[model samples]
Target: MQTGKIGVTTENIFPVIKKFLYSDHEIFLRELVSNAVDASQKLKTLAITGDFRGEQGDLAVRIKIDEKEGTLTISDNGIGMDAEEIDKYINQIAFSGVSDFMEKYQDKAEAIIGHFGLGFYSAFMVAKKVDIITKSYKEGAKAVKWSCDGSPEFTLEETEKESRGSDIVLHIDDDCKEFLQKSKIEELLNKYCKFMAVPVILGKKQEWKDGKMQDTDEDNVINSVAPLWSKSPSEIKDEDYKSFYRTLFPMNDEPLFWIHLNVDYPFNLTGILYFPRVKNNIELQRNKIQLYCNQVFVTDQVEGIVPEFLTLLHGVIDSPDIPLNVSRSYLQSDANVKKISSYITKKVADRLNGIFKDNRKDYEEKWEDLKLFVNYGMLSENDFYDRAKDFSLFTDVDGRHFTFEEYKTLIKDNQTDKDGQLVYLYATDKEEQFSYIEAAKAKGYSVLLTDGQLDVPAVSMLEQKFEKSRFVRVDSDTIDRIIAKDNAPELDLNETQRDILSEAFQSQVPKLDKSEFMVDVQAMGVDAQPVIITQNEYMRRMKEMSRYQQGMAFYGQMPDTYTLVLNSDHALVKKILSEGEASTKETLKPILSEIKGLQARQTILQQEQGKKKPEEITQEEKDDLSNTEQNLSKQREEKKQVIAGYAKDNGTIHQLIDLALLQNGMLKGASLNEFIKRSVNLIK
Candidate 1:
């Protein structure tokens, strides 16, 4: 036997390989199995190309563990290398200047495994000694045995082999003895080679003979030669896709639908993306998509390869074009990767559009399950928005669905406001906003159910996309005010009467954290509730967006603001004005008179001053104006006390406010309890 140093400039290659060659030493098994797969695939290619005339008999790759000998071997029946090929590919260290390479790359040793075509050397990461015994398929080729003992030096000589193939034998180091375990090697094989094109046999098949586990003579193949995604879409059925989905995500619920991606034009990309039934719990369902390179599993964290939203989809994406091992920065900047991303986006949109066009009823039935994903795609990908624009639908509270264009036509005439804005009404909680929805329907308007996580941003996007169109929450305002075709009927009460009633209602407004209420007198025709709480759609949407967005945290931190609109036509409010409890009215009348007199004086002073600046006005005039404003403010405070007195005794006012609060799902804690109690008392 003759041995020569591995032609390299550095002596510490073994230690560097052990410590940093791969982030997870467990990956050594993957490397070995992958090499075996590549060998088997090469043999198949050679046979197809008419280079190999010999009968390709049983091209299965086998992994054998010899615990007694303290060795593991991966053997494949493929085109084994000759001495010349071995010297060129294995002996010569391709990386120039080993010492500098090690020092510069030690920190990234794990990342460097695949960079220098060092897949074979990765065996040294776990083994102290490695041996390759092979007989090439070429004519007049002799069998050879090559051995290395954890150093640059190696020995190569003639050997005896039964068949034309290669055997990679690894004498596992004492520190990595865990690899000796059968379960460990099997796990690695499953991870990296489960869907490879060639059969990967692990051990003998097990049988439950005699009601006990026993090994059979048959070889136990651990991989599928042809995975689901490799087949034509026409040949596959829904159950096949479902079965494949189970293979990818065993614990997940069955997917709602799947998109089989088979594209070979711009770039070779093939995969199946399944839309799982994600129910409100978002974090649990994310990061399910598995990314593969040439059928070898690379990562399930495919955020770099796929759009941020599509990461929620579960499946296997295999492409030789996408590099197996690279930094996220590399994938992001790679030209082919960008093309692949665009292709994926187009494919997903096309699949969705196809589903919408082929079976709209089925699409509508699945809309509730699909809304979150569609909304996410629309918000995250502009291309997706452009494609989904025609097929994307608006589902109403009554369960009827309409495309964006269809909905526009359905509600254009009635929902269009005097400002020529086509108002798109939507509700978050159908049950909670039932009254608002019904009121909108009464006015010949349809209310959409915009309740998904991405609906807030999507609504904002839709408003921008549709010209002269605005999205209004069903309960954001009264039906008449949401899309006013013409001016609303004027409230009959004069200035003094309106002032007294306004102060009476405003005084009783609840002081909750971060909450502000504005009292509005609406002639809502007595049939409406006395108090209806309406939120500003823009502010509410901004607050909702703040929940998911990072920079908008300030909006989320702020308390929700609502408008406390008082319907002047309601009987309770009319009674509050007409009956006016004596003790409360006595206290309120004088304060009202004082405020009216102060306001009259202030108006007279303002008219006299006319457009003049404070400096231009006389000191007496300025003082008179300031005193009138102060007296008016004080009188309003006094008036508030009278309304508070009436509110304290009047269950109707408290009940109305509580009802509005309950409608908005905002009445909580002790206040909610009080509202419940008041509701019960008022019903009695």
Candidate 2:
């Protein structure tokens, strides 16, 4: 036996390993099991090269947990380290045996996982002491045992091992006894080694015996030696892919489609990316794409590896080229990462395009589920946008779908405005915006259903991409004004009549929370609704963007502003205006006369002030102008209050306002109750 201090620059390395080696202490199992598998694979490589004349028996990596003894052992039947090799690989903390093997057999070696050689030290995180019993495959080689007790001091001695392999025994620490539990170890194996290249055996297979689960003699393998992503796409059946998907996520719905990624030219990447059915909640679908390094699970938070939008996809991505740190918990920034991202983006776009081209009817059938993913990709990645535009679809409220170019061709003749811009009309809620959609359809315009979570930003991005095109919500404005081909008809009412009508209706508008209304009297046809509520497109989009974007919370805090458009040609509005004028003309006559005199003085004072420099103007002149403006505002407000008073008692005005609110799904609670009662009374 030979005992000595571990060759190290500092004695504090063991403490660092115990406390800060890994973010999670559970990662120690993954590290140890991965090392065992690497040894097995290295033995296979040597066997293939005719370097070893040994029998390649069961290469399965087995794990055993002794709860009473408080020891968890991971054993492998493969090439093991002799005393000399252990001294070189184990004593030297950072020297990697896998790296040395790869340098010699780069083309022949099977998936070798170790790189930093720090994986062995991760055992100290949860183990008070660790023992390695190994026997080399070389002829006449001696078995060796290495013991370390969570310190730089370690012992190396001769040991008896019948097989040519290694056994890593972890004496779990008192605070880390969870590693000794069978269920806990099995969980770690499932998460970190589910798709490992080597078959991993956890324990005996269980059977229901005498109304309870009992361990049988059969070995229970926890990992698949060859996952679906590791196979050729041609060899995999559609049902097989779906079965694998169910194995990955048992609770999710059936995927719309999947893309088999197998590229070796630019960078080594292989995986299956499934396009899951993404509904309204985009956030719930993130972090599903698992990243693997040579089939060893690295992480599921593959944010920088794939495009941000592709995070919505669910599947596995295995690539040896992706750079990782010692822990392999986080991805490191590298040029290969960006290359992989671009390659994945291209593959996704290509798969979508292929599906669209091959079976457009089927693509349309799946569009409802695929819209969120495609829209997100187009909105977030410009390169993806360039490729996705051909396959991305625009679904109308009538359940009809069209590609961007196809929709452009279908509507270019009629939906083009006088400015030669193609107007794309869309609606968010089909039932709530039914009236607006009908109005747009009456004008022979198709209205798309832009109701996805990302549609707000996606529409904005499309506006920038489409040439001379704009996306307008069907309820954003009157159909005639939204895609105006001719000048609007003039209103018959004068300015005072229009102002009175606006004020009267505005007074009757419901006081909704976080909402403001601006009354606008338009000369819509007599058949049009008396009142229609529409939101400003830019402000509404900004508010919607605040839900998904950062640094835009100010828009979310602002009150929702809507335009209450009253058709001047409609009978109800005309009658209201006529009655308001008849009732308030007598009271507003004196006020109007006073306002006119104050306004004349105000205009004269403003013109005089504008001609003189700020220093030349007298303070008394400024006061006179200010006084005239205040008086004029006071008289106008008095006239409005008189009109508002008349409107306050008018149930017709209140009913019309409530009707518009109801159409937009904004009338709620007490206000909605009031509208119902008033509607019944008016009917009676």
Candidate 3:
């Protein structure tokens, strides 16, 4: 027997590990169980290599809880360390100082176990005292028992035999009795060791007999030694991939498609990535991709390994190249990590392209489900954008789909504007913008459905990617204005008459909060709607961007500005103009005649003065010019008042204004009620 203090430069190392090693205390189970699996695998390797002459049998790890004895034991038939081996690996924890050790591994607590030879010490965190009983597999090896309290001192001696390998017995502290509960150990094993490459047995399998669960002779193995991700892609069938996905996420809908990743040369990476139905609530499904080291589970928060956009996918990514317990910042800065991200991006794009080229009908059927993820990748990753554009599609309102190149070629002949730029028309809400879409279709123009959550940002990105192309919403303008092939005819109304008609309808428009309108009269064909409401593309796009991103709050805060266009050629607009002209003509005629005479006199006086030098100009001439200008200003005011008087009580003007508002989904609440009542009265 022997007793000695642990060999450490600092007085002891246990306190340092307990304080700075694990921020999450529950990871202790993962560390201890993982160490046992590693030991078991090592023994198997030694037997295969002829280093150990003894038989290699039953490498299964077992976890047992003795609730009455208040202890938990993890036993494994693996390589067990003699006293000298234990002293080299465990006793000598070479610590310079707490600050130095912490500074070295501050942000990397997860990496400490395998990298720093501290896997066994993690048990001390939850156990008041721990005992290691073992007989090494090496020839002439004597069985030994090692015991320690939570301190620097320990006892190592030859003791009663165990078959071989080691047993780690933990006398759990009062605060950590949760580890002794069979259910608790089972849960931790399920989480961290579910995919480990060795059989981990927790307890006996249970059967429901006599209305209760009882143990059977069969062992309850808690892990899959060779999970689906570790297998070759050719060995996995589609249903097998789906079965694995269902196990990973049982409550989720079956994935639309999956990409099997298997790369070996520059960096070892293997996994399966599933493209789930992400059309709705993209933010809800993010971070479902898991990252693993070899077969050991590392983290589901894999934003550092997988690109931010691909985090929407679900499945496992195993790579021994990436450190299992590194900081996110460290992971992101790794060269291997960058290569892994680029490879994944290329792989996903290739898979999508293959599916599209092979069975376009099936691909189109799944486009609605795949849209959010594809758009996100294109918008976030540049290389992904370059590849995705080949297979990405545009679905028209008629439910027919076309590739970007195909659609651009189809529309370039007629839809290109006078500035040599092609115009792509789209609709967000097919139901609300139904009339606008139909109007566009009437003119032989196709409107696409860009209604997904990411479509707003995607539209802005596509415009930059496609050559000399722009995307416009169907309801953003009149059909002719949205994709202008030729100049629209000008209205024949005079300036004063135009003002009179505009004022009449503008005054009757409902007063909505955070809304503004500017009225314009256009000579559209008589068949067009009498009044149409349209929003400017620039402001609307900016507001849409503000909803998902930062730095555009100013645009979001501004009122929605709409262009209220009144068609002068329509019979209803023509009637309103005629009625307004008749009612205000008599009052405005005398004031207009006076203003015309005064303006002619002022023009003559200014011309005569221009012919003379500043000092030579007569004082009487200056007075004449000043009086003419004042009279002209006063006359314009009187003319405006007469137009206002006729506009205040025009019923036709109010009805036309409401019709445009209702079509655009802008009319609501008390104003919508008023519009309904007035519409009923007009019908009567």
Scored by TM-score, the top model is 2
Name the candidate that leads on lDDT.
Answer: 2
Q: Candidate 3 clashing pairs?
A: none
Ten-residue stretch with the least lDDT total in model 3: 323-332
Assess candidate 1 and give its TM-score to the true structure: 0.89
Compared with the true structure, all predictions reach lDDT values of 0.78, 0.90, 0.82
Candidate 3, residues 1-684, lDDT tens digits: the string is 989987766755677777776655667777677777767766765665666778778678899999999898988887787877766666766322222423644543221224446667878889999999888788888888888897889888998776888899999988999998889899989888898877899889999999999999999999998899889988889999999999999999999989999998799899999999878777789878877776777678887678888899999998867754321112435888888888888899899999999999999999998988889999998888889998999988889899999998888888888789899999998999998898888888889998888888999999998888899998787878777666756679898778877877776677789999988888778888899898899999998899988899988999999989889999999998899999988888898789889888888888999999999987887888888898888987777677767877777787888888888778889888988998899899
Query: What's each prediction's TM-score?
Result: 0.89, 0.95, 0.91
Write candidate 1's Cα lDDT for 502-575 as tens digits. 66667766788888888777787777778888888878888887877899998888778788888888888888
TM-score of 2: 0.95
Candidate 3: list runs displaced more than 4 Å.
94-113, 326-332, 591-641
lDDT of model number 2: 0.90
The C-alpha stretches of model 1 lying farther than 4 A from their native spots are: 12-23, 47-55, 94-116, 279-281, 326-332, 581-593, 604-625, 668-684
